[model samples]
Target chain A: MREDHHDQPHAPDHPMTEFEWRVDAVQALLIEKGVITADEVRRAVEEMDARTPAQGARVVARAWVDPAFKARLLADAKATIAEIGITVGFDATIVAVENTEKVHHAVVCTLCSCYPRGLLGYPPDWYKSLNYRSRAVVEPRSVLSEFGLELRSDVEVRVLDSTADMRYLVIPVRPAGTEGMSEEELADLVTRDSMIGVAQARTPALR
Target chain B: MTRVHDRGGWPGSGPIDKSEHDLSWWEKRTDAIASLLMSPEKRVMRVDELRRAIEDMEPARYEQSRYYAKWLHAIETIMAEKGVLTREEIDRKVRELSARR
Candidate 1:
């Protein structure tokens, strides 16, 4: 939901809506009832703020170099991600799907804004969009092309639709010509878009 | 069964907005509330209940609002259902806050 909802009016464009007031109203109610402390709410915001795509980049870079780790990540994504210190929210499971030369994997939460928040941080604005939710499922190739990512025709495009309980992380193929790069350096080539399978990993020149 | 929240692959949907935006102050609070409510240890509200609450809104409202607005609305609805707070209290709080501004 973080993206600019172009179809919707902005709060700045007008006064706060009824629901906007409700957000503040509800928080005040919770604080007064002792259901949740103000500190906890502050910390929750801090927790999300602390996460970044860098965490996901680190995971992707490690997967690129460590065949063993990639195997584990593919087998049991949540656990393997935890081994590298990525912890998803309790209500969800993170699934890692790899893209190879023969098949490309793209992710979409057709239902809602489900995402691998533990790794890539908050879902990007576009990911929560109604346009993306609908388009990515049936027209992934076209959608990817919109992002300027044109896949080879030979590669089969697979769209992984995320659910509330199970989210997906697309492990894009490492770009060629970076044979000796360290994991840290390799991390630099991974972008948030690439991890979501909207774009390819950065080539050496891009890094 | 196809609610407005079930938005996958709907033809003639608006164009996707790829631009990212900063979390506004209230948006941050909404996110925090959602996370806090979903925590198992807290047991304040369940995601299923929240989703249902969101879907229960009129289609026009659903179409007009953004994502976090849905969460905030759902949380307000579900929390009231669970006896955590009443709608009256929320409205009074809103009025009180507005008067100060």
Candidate 2:
């Protein structure tokens, strides 16, 4: 569980801020009023913490190895993922964008940190930064460059802006020279940044 | 006018900070509470309402606030708005908790 960027200033040993105190008070009052129980909150925390990019990596690896599953995923991401036992608890529609030989796709929620949290877990701090929110849509190539991803001139870059009701998952093109690798091995190459389209999947030689 | 929270395509923003830190206990607790409040079974508040509250914030405050802090602020605002909790009660509880520390 990575700490959010703002909470960095006040470590656990440090005194709680007014806002942190308010968070505690809010939970206490909610429980007292029967609005929510302590148990429910604990369970919710565990559920959220359990989700990580590993889930998305598995999905990517499955898509890489299984053509039929890839077709199903690209056609309908939410239902397809649910078929593999990944529950999308939220109501938002997830669209899986594939990176082909001619096109690349990236995702950003310019309005807020709206992401495919149900699939990829909590977004990283940089994804929520104002810089990413502002620039990802306008200058995706340069942003990708900052992440050390240089795409060929022939491959077009399309930045998908996620709204509250819609999200995107980028399925990076499979890396070269792993023709005989199993799904589990391929999953290891699917970095979180690759799924976000800032970088490509790791090549077998690099690994 | 483009709102602060709606920051797409606005120019001159600096480099992104890619560093990550471990979530503090309270931070995780805050996330849990917020998530439960918005869950289907609870329906205490919707995510859209939370986003609206955060967007309605003053620009300077919105820019300065942290990710989960923004979430906390929105949760506080919505809880108060829906009469699920009152601002006075929350403030009083905060004061009481502060004194105990």
Q: Give the winner by lDDT.
A: 2
Tell the DockQ for candidate 2.
0.69
Give the per-residue lDDT of model 1 (tens digit) for A33-132. Answer: 8888777888888888777888888888999999999999889888887897777657677788898999898888887777878667778889888899
- Ten residues in a row with the worst lDDT in model 2 chain B? B20-29
Query: If you score just chain A, what TM-score does every candidate get?
Result: 0.88, 0.91
Query: Which residue segments of model 2 deviate by more than 4 Å?
Result: A1-12
Q: Residue-wise lDDT of candidate 1 within B1-101, one digit each (tens)?
A: 67888887787976677899987777877988888988988977888888889888899998788888888889878888888888899889889866754
**On residues B2-59, what C-alpha lDDT tens digit does candidate 2 reach at each position?**
7788788887887777787767667788888888888888888888888999999889
Local distance difference test, per candidate?
A: 0.83, 0.85
> For model 1, what is the error of residue B5's alpha carbon versus the real structure, in angstroms, after optimal superposition?
1.9
Candidate 1's error at B47, in angstroms?
Answer: 1.0
Clashing pairs in 2: A3-B21, A3-B22, A3-B23
Q: Which RMSD values do the candidates have, in order?
A: 5.3, 4.2
Which 10 residues in a row give candidate 2 chain A its minimum summed lDDT? A1-10
i-RMS for every candidate: 3.2, 2.3
